[model samples]
Target: MPRGKYTNHKGRNRRFTNPEELEEQRRKDEQERRWRQQRGDESSESEEEEDEADKKKASGSKTRGDDDSGSGSEDSSESENSDEEKAKGVSNLIKIENPNRVQKKVKKLSTLNEDLVSQKPQLSRREREEIEKQRAQAHYQKLHAEGKTEQARADLARLAIIKQQREEAAKKRDLEKKQKEEALKAKTAQTQKALGKKT
Candidate 1:
């Protein structure tokens, strides 16, 4: 139905009154009508249900409280039965047999003087890896402590180049990750027709 005259950006015929086009338009209008009707029916049914519940509550309030006590007790017993069944399959994660024993363990660990321990302080995972790399490069230096200074210098130069290359690679990977996230957002918007929904 040539209802509006806007350019066909995606290059379909600008006029839309042809039989196939009219049928497609009719289908769309029918779908929209069904959606609106469903929403309206749901709202009316809920209003009726709420009114019925309010009427029942108003009538119940006039009765004596003791009249519903029997039903309340039955509900309480049913809930307790279900709770017991639920507990049968449940297990506690940490069983604390004696709280005092845990306190003693904490005290013993804390009371030890730091300086008295002859062992070297432990390195963290990353620090240990860097330390191992430094040690391996310095091994050639140790043999040449009394001689051959040029070999030690060459080894240190090589280690510096390796560290620089690793840093550059890390930066490249971070840039790629950001590009991938942007592409995914664009693809999701296209697939879900979010741009069309806004219109």
Candidate 2:
């Protein structure tokens, strides 16, 4: 099936068969726009303040009560109400007139031109590599300072071996000292025994 002009979802078409139907549709759209404008509903504006509207109603009633108490006619109060409606319509318009104004965004978009040639000297790849190397070295140094690095573990193992060797040397010195003391005592006893026999 051939695709329709209006909607090509499944070769479907939507259109008015009569010119009068189109006119009627246009009229309905215009009426909707006029109604929204009078109702103070706008695309750019948020919902009108309920408290402000209540205040206006309260003030209007107060004026009406005063007019009722006085001899003022009802026409004056109707005009005042119309003026308030006009003020509301004027407030619904966008106040800022800038065309370059930024709209709110969830994701950021870059503004830099990628194709533009530059005269200024750009940083070489080696510069960036050096920066990365320096960062890694600094990070490792911090870990070493905290004694949480692999180097710290290796040093601890080396220190344990040195301590064991020192302890063994100290035990050997103690044994040698004991043997020298025993030999000196034996020699002194032998000399004493010989002198006593001679006496």
Candidate 3:
């Protein structure tokens, strides 16, 4: 006699007799309510426009399907032509060019120098310097803790040798550059003298 309960001929209650079914129904109802709420947030005008667009698309697809069914070979050719036209239209609408080729020419001494400058390391210069200083200080402290005073002096001597070697390499490079410039100047002068003699 309950409002939603029905007594079968065997006198069994049939209203939500299965708990799993009741839970499933509740879940479905909840999902539907959420979907409706989401749909309700959009403006009515936008919703109507979307509905009209969908209806038009549905009708168009249905007409295309009917045409394909009515005339098989002709419809297939038309569809292919339409696809090609669509592709052409899209390609015309979106023009793509290579960014590097389009940009201004970059003057660099060498690609190696460009790569070195452009490549970003994980740590910044200041952070790397700080880390190196901390490591060196830790190493010096460890040496002093071990009472190896001579080892610290040897480390300093090694660093001085490294510095001297770097300075010598720089000077050698400068000398080579100067030599190349002088050789170029002499070659030009010889060419000028030969031209004068010929004239």
Candidate 3: misplaced stretches above 4 Å?
A: 1-148, 197-199
For model 1, how big is the CA root-mean-square deviation? Answer: 41.3
lDDT measured at residue 121 in model 1 versus the true structure, 0 to 100: 88
TM-score of 1: 0.25
State which candidate, 1 or 2, has the greater TM-score. 2
Q: TM-scores across all candidates?
A: 0.25, 0.32, 0.25
Q: Which stretches of candidate 2 lie over 4 Å from their true place?
A: 1-122, 195-199
lDDT of 3 by residue, 58-167 (tens): 43322222223213565687577545544433463233555467666776679868878899878988999999999999998998767588877787789899999999
Clashes of 2: 0
Q: How well does candidate 2 score on lDDT at residue 83?
A: 53
Q: Is candidate 2 or candidate 3 better by lDDT?
A: 3
Model 1: per-residue Cα lDDT at residue 196: 65
Ranking according to lDDT, highest score first: 3, 2, 1
Q: What pairs collide in candidate 1?
A: none
lDDT of 2 by residue, 20-68 (tens): 5644654564455556657877751222224323544543322222222
**Model 2 TM-score on a 0 to 1 scale:** 0.32
Ranking by TM-score: 2, 1, 3
